[model samples]
Target: MAHRLLVCRIWTLSAKEIRCLPASSTAIASTSFSTSLQPSSSQVSFLSPSHGLPRSFTHTTRRQVSFNVQDNEDFTERVINSQLPVLIDFHAQWCGPCKILGPRLEKAVAKQKGRVAMAKVDIDDHTDLAIEYGVSAVPTVIAMRGGDVVDHFVGIKDDDELDSFVSKVIGK
Candidate 1:
C-alpha cells in the first residue's frame, strides 16, 4: 500500500542529508558473509556534534527550555485545551530527523515569545497519543487551534520553512 511505503520512507535517511553532517573517517571491520566482492574491513565514521556527547554533559548548562508532555492526560489538558495555539512535535528518541527538527521548532516557538506554545511528545513513550493524531513517523509537527488540528508537516524542514510554518500557525 502507498501508506505503508510512506511510513517506511520516513525512517530512511537520504545520502544528501547524511552528507550534511561532518564526519571523520575510521576503519571498521566488515561483518558481511559474501564471497564474490568483499573487503575484510571498511572505513567508516560519522559525527553528529550532539550525538557524540553525553546527554547530561549537554544539558548541564542549557536552560530548562523544553515543553515535553508528560503523558496522555497532560497532552489532553495542555495541548487540546490550551488558549494559545499549540505546536505539537511528535518525535522518537531513535529518529534522526527528530533530532534535526527539535531545536529548530523550539527556536521558532521562542521567537513567538508566548504568542504560541509548543509541546513535545516522544512517540515511544506516548504511542496512544501518536496513534490518536495519526502520526506514522517521527518529527511530525501538528498545529492546533481551539482544540482542532489546523496545520501540520512531516520531515526536517529548514529554518526558513520552520519560521514560516510557525508564523502561519500563529497567524502572524
Candidate 2:
C-alpha cells in the first residue's frame, strides 16, 4: 500500500494538468514535502505577497543602488561629474565596521531614492583612491558635490544619523 502511495505521489508531481484533485489525494498533496517537490509552472506566477496579480500583470519595478567604483576613470565619470550628489563609502572587506555600516548607508541612500547615489570603494582594492581621499580609517563615508568633497564622516552611524547625513548631502 505504501509503494502504491509513493507511485501516486510521483505521478501527481509529474502531471501538471491535475488540479483540484480528490480530498483523499489532497491529504498527501497538501503536505509540505509534496508542495516543494511539485514542478514549477511558468504559465502564471505570483509577484505580490497576496498573490493578487500574475507576474506579467504586476507593474512594480526595481531601482539600482550601491554601485561599485571600478577604476579612477570610472570614478571621475560617474561620481565627480555626476549631476546628482554622490555618497562614497570607503570600506574594506575584512573590516567589521565596514560590513555593518555598508548596509546601513545603502538603506539610508535608498530612502532618498533617485535624489542621491552611492558608490562603494574597497580600500584594499583601490588604495590610491583611499589615500587620495585621506581615509585613515575603515568605513569612511564621503559626500561629493561637483567632483569635490563637500562633507564626510568616519566610523559607523545609526540609520537615523545616516538618513540625516544623506539629507544634508542632498541639501534637504
Candidate 3:
C-alpha cells in the first residue's frame, strides 16, 4: 500500500485551488492571496483616436515581462541558482508601492537581459522566500551572486541609482 498527500487553496476574487494526483508537487498557501491566473495575452494597445493609424490599424509594441530565474529554492533551480548574477524582486500585487516600482524594475531587467537574470517572487505566495530574505515589506529588491545575496534595494528605487548599483556589484 502507498500513501498520498494533497493540498488546496482558494481566495477571494480568485479561482478555486485544487491539488490533484499522487502529490508529485505541493503548494503551501493561505487564504489572503489573489492570483492573476489568466493566460498571458501578448497584445497591449496604447492608441489614441487623433494620432493613430486611421480608425483601425492601431497597435503598440507588446512587451513581455520577464524576470530572470535561478535555482535558489527561494526562487527556483532555473532562477536564483543561475551562474550569472541575478536580481530578485520580492513584491505583492496588492501593495501600492509595488505598482509604482514595477515598471522601473522591468526596464532594468530589459536593459540587462542577457547579462543578468531577473526573478520576481510574489511575497503573498512565496512566503518562504520572503522569510528567507527577511523581507518585512513589499517591493523588496535584491541582487544575488553565486547563490548568496550581494546587495539589495528596498522601497522605491531611482533608475540612475539602480544602474550604478548594478554595475558596481557586477564589476562592470
Candidate 4:
C-alpha cells in the first residue's frame, strides 16, 4: 500500500540522515563489508567533498527540502513522545548563527540518535509557533524532556557544555 511505502521511505530517509553525521564514516571500514559492495545500477552519481572524488549513490533521491512549519501540532508528541530526550533547533533559514549551528547540531544528533530526537523548525514558515514560543530570534536551541521546556541556550555552546547539559537533564 502507499502508506507502507511512505513509511519505508521515511525510515530510509532517517537512515540516510543518520549516516550523514560525521562519526559514522570513521566506523564504516571496520565493519568488513565495505570492500564487498558490488556497484549497482540503482545508484545515483555525485561527487565527494572529503576526498574530492566522484561517487555514486546506490540509493536516495533527497530533494532539496527543509522541515515544515508546525503549529497547533502537538510538539509534545513529536518531542517528548520520543523514547529519547528531544532537541529542537529553532531556526530560520536566513539567520547567520543558524548556518553555523547546523553542523554542531548534526554532530550532536549523530552522537545521540537513539537517545535523542532532533527536530528543526523554520520560524518564517511557522509564525504561529514562533509567536507561541516567544522565539524572537533565530538559532535558539531548546532541549525538552517529558513534553516540557526544561532549558535552552541561544547561539553556540561548546560540545562539552552541551554534553553535560544533556546528561544532567536526561539523567544519563
Best-performing candidate as measured by lDDT = 2
lDDT (10s digit) by residue, model 2, range 1-172? 7757755554545233334445555445334223344464422222112443222346867787779999999999999999999999999999999999998998999899799999999999999999999999989999999888999999999999999999999993
Q: Candidate 1 residues 1-172, lDDT tens each? A: 6545633442254545444533321111112112335443432223233333212324455443458999878888999999999999999999998999999999988887778989999999989888999998778999999899999998999999999999999893
lDDT (Cα atoms) of all candidates against the true structure: 0.75, 0.80, 0.62, 0.61
Kindly list the per-residue Cα lDDT of model 4 for residues 68-103, writing each as its tens digit: 336545565676575667777888888888888766
Q: Which residue ranges in model 3 land beyond 4 Å of their true spot?
A: 1-65, 68-74
Clash numbers, per candidate: 0, 0, 12, 1
Every model's TM-score? 0.62, 0.68, 0.57, 0.55
After superposition, the stretches of candidate 1 with alpha carbons farther than 4 Å from their true spots are 1-65
lDDT of 2: 0.80
lDDT of 4: 0.61
Our model 3 lands, by Cα RMSD against the true structure, at 19.5
Ranking by lDDT: 2, 1, 3, 4
Error of 2 at 42 (Å): 28
lDDT of 3: 0.62
